[model samples]
Target chain A: MIHSDLIRRLPASMKLAAALAVVLLVTAACGGGSSSGGGDTAGAAGLEGKTVNFVGYGKDNPWGAYFNGVFVPKLESQGVKVVDLTTMDPGTAVTNFNQAISNKPDLIVAALLDTSSTVVPIKKAKQAGIPVLVFDGRPDPSVDADVMQVLSDSEALGTAAAQNLVEGLKAQGRNSGNLIAITGTKSGFAAQDRMKGFDAELAKTPEYKVVDIQDGNWDPTLSGKIATQLFAKYGCSGIQGAYGMADYQALPIVAAAKQAGCPVGGKTGLVVTGSNCFKVGIDAIKAGTLYGTATEDPGTIAEQTADYVIRYFNQQNPPAKELVKEERVTAENVAQFAEQCSKA
Target chain B: MNVMSAPPRSDAPIRRPGRSRSRAELVIDAVLLLAVLAAIVLALTTHRFATVANAKAILTSASLVGIAALGLTLITIGGSAVSLAISPSVAAVGMIFLSAQSFGLVPALALAVLCGILITGVQGAIVGYAAANPVVLTIAASFAITGIATGVSGGSTVSPTGGGYDRLNATPGGVALSVYVLIGLALIVQWTLRRTGFGRSLYLIGENRRAARAAGLPVGRTTAVAWLAAGALFAVTAAFTAAFNTSANVNLGGTLTFDAIAAVLAGGTPIAGGRGSALRTLAGAVLIAAASDILLLRGSSTGVQILVKGVIVLVVVVLVHLRTEGSRA
Candidate 1:
């Protein structure tokens, strides 16, 4: 009551001054704290007052959420001005890229969903004198428009999923059997790369044959339906393992398999694995309904991408290509990664 | 020359214009029968395709699309054409359901369905009362709903924290709860359309809007009711979908709008409206589901399956159109 009365007695200008001082103090404290934290490059030279155009998926997409929620804020905290040109539609994303290039910000950060359509806009951005930092997608190798590309290593995710599935199968006392792969959109770069890696890794253990590779389009319903049909076609005993490209897809596959009387996971039944470390996969691992999942975590990818951006601005000479490290999470290690996966 | 001249009249009961089985209806029936026959033949030939497990799979897969189609059927019947907003509405409701799950199952579901009704119902009002173009209005609504849902969710998946709703995903006696729900809803919707005054008004308005207006029928009210009912069905679809997946996201109802529209057209419902049955839509949904499953089981690619579905829809549409046109002539 006394403090309120004293403030009421003060003039409006004095109150305004006090508020400004408090804000400055808070800002300084945050800046000091952030510089010593994970965002060590906060307020780094060259980044302050710089402008960056971020063209990627809309905030509704999980990866887009990470970019907007984590990457943009991290960069902004360092005094970088970010212009959001994100979109949910692939077509709109292309348009946004062109718009961003026209704007000619000091730097451009893009994560195009359709890699095939990105090369031209990337070149256009380069011609506009904008240094592009790409993430989440890998454009053609010949397209050297980007200063650096930070990717989740989709192939490694696939490889890890394959390894986990194999390990699960072996643990179930099976050396060789039929496996099925339910992939995302067939034309997507990530899906194609993941499949390539998966196939390559599975080749080492030729005894386990991939009976089918169906496109689930990263849709849970479609994936579940595909699983149901595959299980029926192969029966409960014919197929011993499966791979769903995402945890959402993987969870449905488990349900469909169970419905088909071919329960997955544990020491028996079909072994299932997925990528994209989502909370669903972690929970499934905990419940022993899913064998494992590989880390294609959006949160980690976003953080690493933000770090690369800071480095690029600091002239630290980041490599042309940076692959975010990924790991497999099974029942043995799911607990360790559950919190991170859940956050994603 | 003598246009006003009156002739001697005989007392005979004047018959009202009523729905009679048309050539288009016949074509739809024939197509459905052929599809069933083809399914049976494939089942006989392919050991894997004939299993009880595959049947359950087909029905379970069809359930969500079937439910959504039932709602779209009402809109189509009420002469509003199709709502491009169905998928977004479904996604929004699913998100709402998951978001409200902390309130417990019944309330969450009720709230979710209510949200669906409000979303589509408002659009319906615009289209009905304001005489807005449904296609354009629904397209705009789709964008708005998607934007709102995305903003609210921040593009994150909404996972359910509670139980009980998982019962909707259960398969009792090898039949999914979703499948049963679809059947039950189908029966109710069919009865409603056939036996209710609102249903008759929809047919009347859809059949001839000018004539219905001239006859003092409640055209706007019927259209709104159709949309409201459809919204409820869509909510049910979202609920079952979220329950089955154990999660929901802004992408919850991927390809649903197109699929439901396709199902409605495939069911032999005239795009011009006024003529169709929920049972026909059910048959169409089942046929499409079975065909897709058969294609998948045969190792066909997604492209091939989509191509096949396109062919089926096109063939049905062309046949029905031709038959309807011929009958009109």
Candidate 2:
């Protein structure tokens, strides 16, 4: 009541100016609150007209395709102009990242091929007062340059793969048998973590011995070759189950096994499981050639990464590190993930 | 100086002093004998190395590299040095095949081969007519091919819409179709190298380009034909690889160039050219494959396999160098 009376007593011009000032103050308060509250579309206004530089890797592979397909469009839809510096080569990726830092965009988003190679440039970006958002690979915990990171639970995915393998074996009416692990390049962090998790989980089941572990190098052709050699070395009856680090790798094993005259996928046949929930794996699962697979869907991780980017810009302060959840997909639950996996 | 009269000797059978050729052949034979003895020792020592399944595995794995090496042998013989573009070309052709599969299998395969021909044909024309460095030209071609493939495919894996071509992966009579293809191609290529005028011209041109040019030989054309033949074989390798994987990507056959080169070198083909055979490349591919399989069976790491292959290449290179030096002396 007092505020209204004061306005009424003022001259007409003074009253108009005072009312305008109050309106502007209220608008500012609302916008600030909305941005801080982490409202989905609320903070997008802040990103308008800003530029982001994206340094990525493996633009040719499925995981990279899915992530780039989703993430770039989302940011662009909010009026964020993106500069793409994606490359498949590790050395080239570092050069691109440094170039991105020099561009000094409003933000720097990167998915480095190797963290060790980019630590120096990331520090430079930090010193420049530019925020960095990392995805696909987590930076070293000691590094303070990265504002936040969104990564797949690769170790958990590996554990899920082991669980699926065991379940597939049980479903095939076997409690004890020999198994082979066809993994990606042994030096890769993802491959190593997956194997570590696989070993930790498989240790609980002592009867199932890992007779051999060969590096497939994440190559389908090499994996197929390794599968053939493994089949020859182990014989059709000697091994009962197999684990492929990815669905593409697992599918080749299925083909190789068929060529080797080894029965696969039936109750009495060999049990095969893969990870990475690729469409090929989903299709094979539907076709009954693949026993099971674990979900490390690139699309899901990408979406979360996008959300974190939005949150960061809005000053909502997303967590320093986020590990996306992973699950195992088998015949029983394959239908639920079929659509997403197909997209991946 | 009558160009034709300057080298009447060029038309009378292109020979390399006879002794050097025979010594090289003898060294190749010794290498083959050593490979055989090693295989026998592995079979006796290893538990499952002697099985038919194991033999099939080795041959099946070797066939891919064997086919590519066979074509590479022609290039090496024609004095073009080695091509570093084989892997990229194979990958590009595989992508082309998968993309064109909607128009029946044979048409897609033909299109793929034509694309491969066009790709290497340009490189051949440059190397043959312009006398460009084969290694540098092929390296540049690899970059261009990889870039184009990535852009055209949008850096995604290409999968066939239909399954009609899966029969290409079939094993007939307990032998892989790829092995049969490799053997058939090797025989045809070997026969052509022995009987054709083009083959004789290649040998003459490779041994002494100046003499062949003075005698009015088609040096440039023969070199180009060698490259074209290699491209066609590379296309065949791509087809089999894509059919086996049921998908094609830019990374397809990533290690193929190195493997193919290794096969050519191990086959006892002199890098200086003028002599070699497709059958030798096949044998070399088989030996390498068998060695890899044996190592794998014995639980060796990939590093060890690579190290052993490096050692084999080093030994073969040194042995060839010694023989050539000895013969010259």
Q: What TM-score does prediction 2 earn?
A: 0.87
Q: Is the docking of candidate 1 incorrect, acceptable, medium or high quality?
A: acceptable
Please list the residue runs of candidate 2 whose C-alpha ends up more than 4 Å from where it truly belongs after superposition.
A1-45, A140-147, B1-43
Candidate 1 deviant stretches above 4 angstroms: A1-45, A144-147, B1-47
* Highest-lDDT candidate: 1
Tens-digit per-residue lDDT, B1-329, candidate 2: 44323322221124466434666657765885896687688766987888899999999999998999998988888888899999999999998887788888899889888988888878887888788999999999998998888777777777776665577788898777899999999999987887777777777667777787888887788888888988999999998888887777888877999889898888777788776777778887987898899899888998888788777777766776666565555
| Deviation of model 1 at B227, angstroms | 0.9
Looking at candidate 2 chain A, the ten consecutive residues that score lowest on lDDT are A33-42
* lDDT digits (tens) for residues A1-344 of candidate 1: 99999999999999999999999888655543221211212234578877788986787776567657888889899988999998877898899987776665667788877877888887765555567888886887668545468988999999998998889888878888899999999888889999989999999999889999999998887888788788878888988988999998988888888777776776788888988978877888888888999887877888998898888788787888999999989998988899888864
Q: Which pairs of residues collide in model 1? A: A60-B155
DockQ of each: 0.38, 0.38
lDDT of 2 by residue, A1-344 (tens): 99879767999999789889999888755643322222222335477777778887666665787788888899899777889998778898889887776676777788868767888878766766666778876675557435567878889878888888888888777879899999988877788889989999999998888999999989888888889899999899988889989887898888788778888888888889999888778878988889999888878887888888777777686777888888889999999999878764
